[model samples]
Target: MQYFLVSNDPDRRARWHDRLKAAGLNVTGEYDPSAVIVTIGGDGTILYAARNYLEPRILPVRAGSSKGNRAAFDVDQLVETLQALEDGHAESSSRTFSTLTAEADGKELEGGFQALNEISLHHSSPVLAATFAARIEDDTTWEFPELIGDGVLVATPFGSTGYFTAITGETFTDGFGVAFNNIHTPADTPEMVLCSESVVVEVELLSTKRSSGAVLTRDDDDTPYELSEGETITIRAGDRTVELLDVI
Candidate 1:
């Protein structure tokens, strides 16, 4: 079977290249539209693979984490899993993916904004809290006072198990539609309640220092944000949904 193999670690890359080859499968460094993508690593690596390797193509992800920040699943048995794919055991897999959209200034941000988890707005720098009006799609905007801590985040059920759980957002079951959780501020909580599917939210920085206190990010994070107070950040559910292999 043809598969898309992606691994940033040179050592792991070489190891898997040899291993998968020995397993009797055709592997390509680049994503082949016709090939299933197998991300070899932890969930984070899987996320990275889905984003950078097969983002536009949007294929079902067969992922496992080796280890890192966390290993939601196991990696020791990946070889067995690989064998399953080769044996046609992965064909019955199915999973749903979630995404977020953000627009700064006027132009839309590009590349890797889609998050399988939640989209968050946090402090750009150590300064005043991120304060702005948040409105769900099709709703009017409501303003908030200066923020005290970092910022707020919105996560889906897939993401609910991640940061949202740590922050006390309720765990959202998968395949029940999208979830909005991990809200830090009181106003933001009510704001999300009013949110709808694919709702558009605008966060306007109220701090005048151009404190750039707030920035928007998708699931994987690590994006460059140059926003200041009064600069608006527009966030909404994305049209692109991820397809995860394996129901669980």
Candidate 2:
């Protein structure tokens, strides 16, 4: 299969490019939708590949000092893995991961933002905690009382291992995980909630006498969607899924 190599580190990319070519693998300079993405960086590179390519197969190779939690192979095993696939001794495999989508005030955003991991809404200012309210729909509709906190995040199971785990100290195998960020009120509120993938989570930055707002960010995207006071941001599971290649 044709492969496209990508890395945030230029030196690592050049080195790996030579190795793959030396192994007699078919590598391409330009991205092809049909080509498998060989991500040669940290776990973040995997997310980057998935975001830029449309349903492209991903082969995540661990690199650098970061913890490559989503990596499929290590550097030492790279050429051997390719040989195995070439010889039909080991076949390429894949796993499907879910994604997320958001809307503001009942309208879908222009970019059709879909996050392979989590979508977070945080207080706009560092010194201020925003007041927010959440409405979750599962078997029944439940409205949570207003909360005073830094913000909140909704993560998929594939995302549970990232920020979700850091904030809630837990991971899930399926469904969406909802967690509050540094909440100050309703002290007894559950740290996290595991809801069905089919559930809908709506959060609003409450409008008070003071101007309050939050910033909505997705999966390492540089762009942050802004939410004004009284504006509701809706988060839900996307209809599509991302496939990772050669997962062991």
**Model 2 whole-model lDDT (C-alpha atoms):** 0.83
Candidate No. with top lDDT: 2
Q: Rate residue 79 of model 2 by lDDT.
A: 83
lDDT, candidate 1, equals 0.57
TM-scores, all models, native as reference? 0.75, 0.91
Instruction: Candidate 2: give the clashing pairs.
Output: none
Cα displacement (angstroms), candidate 1, residue 59, comes to: 9.8
Per-residue accuracy of model 1 over 17-46 as CA lDDT, tens digit each: 677778777877766767766655656765
**How many residue pairs clash in all the candidates, one count each?**
13, 0
The Cα local distance difference test for each model comes to 0.57, 0.83
